[model samples]
Target: MANAASGMAVHDECKLKFLELKTKRTHRFIVFKIEEKQKQVIVEKVGDPTRSYEDFTASLPADECRYAVYDFDFVTEENCQKSRIFFIAWSPDTSRVRSKMIYASSKDRFKRELDGIQVDLQATDPTEMGLDVIKSRAS
Candidate 1:
């Protein structure tokens, strides 16, 4: 019984560490177009919101920046101006096997993919491995 409990604790610790690494590796990007007439910048995040849906929008605290620069183009036809801002964040993609393999390799770990199944490089046969087993092995 104690062995089982200790094993569960170890599993939980590994799960938490895995999630921490995943979040650390996750990337976020925002791209939007702004017109000269536009007074405010609108932003939205996709996924489970920490706050209520209604309160999420209101959660964006307004701030004023003293120094700002923008490179904009003029629309001759409409006699207006606009700019497109691209905010890019690059991080690892954990969904795909290749990406996972790359990340693992970078960390001095190795992974292997066989017949559409992902497994540790040490795993000789992944035929019997399920999603849960593969995930546990990823740690």
Candidate 2:
């Protein structure tokens, strides 16, 4: 199939690389970035649940990192959970407001699998989600 946005046909070679991104089933948590239009899933990562909620990247002088979680099971079309995403760039005195979020939807979680489906707040991103799944596969 062709990518609707880029109009680039996903070749057999491209799919082989995508297959490498597959996450094996495990007791761990998994995250998937699914392109609804393309029906292609980019399995992100799997990680320890206890270690997923916090930041572990080397603190950079320019780029900052933070996370957010969205649960579709407990979310409704009208009312929703309020959440925040912070990306404090630079130092303590010169940080930039990178990204922010006050709400999350179940629709966002529908495409990904995580431990205890409904409570994935600790599994911040797809990479963490993938880690959890990979861990499950190992055991």
Total colliding residue pairs, candidate 1: 0
Model 1 regions lying over 4 Å from their true place = 1-11, 26-118, 123-139
lDDT of each: 0.23, 0.28
Count clashes in each candidate, considering only residues at least 3 apart in sequence or on different chains. Answer: 0, 18
Encode model 1's per-residue lDDT on 3-70: one tens digit a residue.
Answer: 22111111132223223223442212111111113322222232131333223222222221111111
Off by over 4 Å in 2: 1-28, 55-116, 120-139
Tens digits of per-residue lDDT for model 2, 55-111: 222212222222222221122346664322111111222233322121122223232
Query: Scored by Cα lDDT, where does model 1 land?
Result: 0.23
